[model samples]
Target chain A: MDPANRPLSPHLQIYRPQITSVLSIVHRISGAGLGLGSLVLAYWLISVAAGPEPFDFAQHLVGSPGGILLLIGWTFGLLFHFCNGIRHLFWDAGYGYELSTTYVSGWVVIVVSVALTVGIWLSVLIAKGTP
Target chain B: MSGRTSLRRVRDLGTARDGVHHWWVQRLTAVALVPLSIWFVTSIILLAGSDHARVTAWISNPIVAVFLMLTLIAMFYHLKLGLQVVIEDYIHAKPTKVACLLLNNFGNTVLALSCIFSVLKVAV
Candidate 1:
């Protein structure tokens, strides 16, 4: 049999989206976002090491409205990836393979990640308000 | 570094023997990040809107610096592994795929080093 001529597996576009499929793709999307977010984190640290001027520049960048929006987005991505990564870990441990369980856990990941993101942002808002 | 195409290499070798090692390390880093990232997020929340001196002081603490570096390392390692899988799964052209793979490795290493160095410079 010619390997080149072998039929390719169906791609993602062919499938009707389900909770399982949707969350699986999101896990990848959020991961990519966090990878970009890490760059911001790296710059924040580098600016600090560079001294006050650079640090202030970075702080201003992050504290600006656009920067704050980006941070909020990254916050949700971080929490979503964090929660969903735990789900992957559990599956790695040879547990939670049942279809019903996967669905339930998928919902749990979504809800928990959203809640955490909101909580963290609210804390940041409250913190800013106080001092 | 071999000249063989990725499809050819993958088909002939089956699992390539190191697949499990990659999977294992990915999981290890994920586990480490679980606590490390939580500590980081919580600390960031606590330090939100803090002044330069306050933020630097937090990073200057030896304990905080240690954890920060640890988190940076684990996060980048895990990210590299995850992105590798994504690229392999989606990118079909051999040269483009290989280029992306190299970028994934080198990019993660550079970022990780920069962040680690920043932590050390402030802490020490």
Candidate 2:
């Protein structure tokens, strides 16, 4: 094959958005978010290890408005990635190939993930009177 | 240049035949992370309002420490693999791509090790 003249795959912008395609892109996006968010996890763990003052500072930071929003975003990203990842595992196992099943599963992933995210936040809010 | 064929020139540059290993490991880590992430998210949520002493004591538990370390390893490995794919997909420039890939690798290793060490320090 000629390297310079090789045909390119359709660029993302060229295609109309569909459930499968949208979710596919979301998987990558959320994966990237969670990957970066792992640093926050590291920060929390290290703060706890560092002891009370640092831990209190960490808590205060996390409790702040910006930090809370970021945490919510990460929470959704984690849940979406988790649910969609299971869908991917099913596809890898040679299931969920039919178009109808793919669409259904895609919606299911979204609804379930959102529900779980809301559930988690509500639980947090009710327990602590804040999120 | 005189005697070597075009195929010979592009041989190793094309496929390294190591993609399957990368793909397989990504899936393996994904599987491992399913339970690990669930355990972690749920634990953090439950620990939400707890003070520093409670949280530290929780991490210091033998079982909790082991799980935390495992979670860190699998989570970092999965993140590294995923980021490598994203970088390869979008970053076309060779030098920048190489630099990002290297940073992805070394940075992930440092992050994972430090997190693990933190857990150990607290647990002990």
Query: Quick one: best lDDT, which candidate?
Result: 2
Candidate 2 lDDT tens digits, A1-131: 88999988997778889999999999999999998799998898889888899999999999998999999999999999999999999998899999999999999999999999999998788878964
Q: What is residue B34's positional error in candidate 2, in angstroms?
A: 1.1
Off by over 4 Å in 1: A1-10, B1-14
> Least accurate stretch of 10 residues (summed lDDT) in model 2 chain B?
B1-10
Against the correct fold, how does model 2 do in TM-score?
A: 0.91
**Least lDDT summed over 10 consecutive residues: which range in candidate 1 chain B?**
B1-10
Model 1, span B1-124: residue lDDT tens: 2334577566865455567668888888999999999999989888877778998899999999999999999999999999999999999999999999999999999999999998899889
lDDT at A42, model 2: 88
TM-score of chain A of each: 0.89, 0.91
The interface RMSD for candidate 2 is 0.7
Please give, for residues A1-131, the per-residue lDDT of candidate 1 as tens digits.
79999988887788789999999999999999999998999999999888988999898889888999999999999999999999999898899999999999999999999998888788778867622
Question: TM-scores, in order shown?
Answer: 0.89, 0.91
Q: For candidate 1, give the DockQ.
A: 0.70
Interface RMSD, all models, one decimal each? Answer: 0.9, 0.7
Give the Cα error of residue A22 in candidate 1, in Å: 0.6
- List per-model TM-scores for chain B: 0.88, 0.87
